[model samples]
Target: MNKLLLFIIVFTLFSCDSKNIEQNREYNYPASKVWKHGVYSKYEARDLEGVFDGLEVDVIYSPEKNDIYVRRVVADTSKNLPLDEWLAMLKVPSKMSYWVDFKNLSKANAKQAMSIMINLLTID
Candidate 1:
């Protein structure tokens, strides 16, 4: 009888611990998983840097420049920020990662875009 009681107590303790761990994991998930999309400007990124774990910006591949730029439309490429410049402005936390929403990432531009992105990232 004593052995059975001891076994029950240990089992109950272990079960409660596992349940609390699961709850903690779920509660902490959103803080790290939350993403802020359409963050195109420095002001927007600055405002949201603390509130979100990830900031996603729309980028278009500029064939003329053979580079990626942070902008929704290709028509106004003159005012659009270069992807590297946009990236440089972001003082992102170590927990955060770059999330570029490529508006015109095709097979033709993918290689060059990737290469450019790689260079930009490596420079940081």
Candidate 2:
């Protein structure tokens, strides 16, 4: 009986890992399980800096459940960043990630889908 109970507890602990989206692009996403999900599109892989900041996009892949995080870099530090430092951080592989927004989402369903993130990000 004790052995069975121990197994059950271990199973429960690992079962809860799930993915959630984060604002901005900073994330701890696992390697692509399916490469893409959600309302993603097939586009050329773009590996560039400054490009990631321009739009609110639906990522081709999202980080692990709630593991993704986005925070504002204190603007004052943006300019002082050394060229090498920035390149190292942003210079990742070029792969087909997605860029989506409510503008492209189906209008009939947009009203409901648009509010999905609001609920996720809400803290009461």
Candidate 3:
């Protein structure tokens, strides 16, 4: 009975301490990080360089062409910019991080696409 009472007391004390910590903790809304979407062109990326913390660009792999193109739709082949060309136009590539929204990545082109991406990243 004594042991049971002592265990309960210790548990209660620890629980209360944790609750106090949680209650005293402060939170701030709307973090500092910002990300922008639909930045598929070099013009857009150049324009939004300092405006956003991160930029998301859509890319589709063309297995027949053996290259990656920046475009929202895979079917709309016109005005499609090659990934390398688009990346080459960035004024400050290191200023903001990029999030590639791969539109049609599959097992058939994953390896090639990764290779192209690696090459793109390595280009100085």
TM-score of each: 0.66, 0.20, 0.69
- Can you write out model 1's per-residue Cα lDDT over 21-49, one digit (the tens) per residue? 53334322345767888888877776776
Q: Where does candidate 1 stray beyond 4 Å?
A: 1-31, 92-94
State candidate 1's TM-score: 0.66
Give the worst 10-residue stretch by lDDT in candidate 3: 23-32
lDDT of 2 by residue, 21-100 (tens): 45597865534434322221112222333243322233211122221112123223223332122223433422223233
Which scores higher on lDDT, 2 or 3? 3
TM-score of decoy 3? 0.69
Give the per-residue lDDT of model 3 (tens digit) for 28-105: 432336788888778888788778877888999998899999998889778679988887887767556778988999
Candidate 3: which pairs clash? none
Task: Tell me how many residue pairs clash in candidate 3.
Answer: 0
List the candidate 3 regions with Cα displacement exceeding 4 Å: 1-32
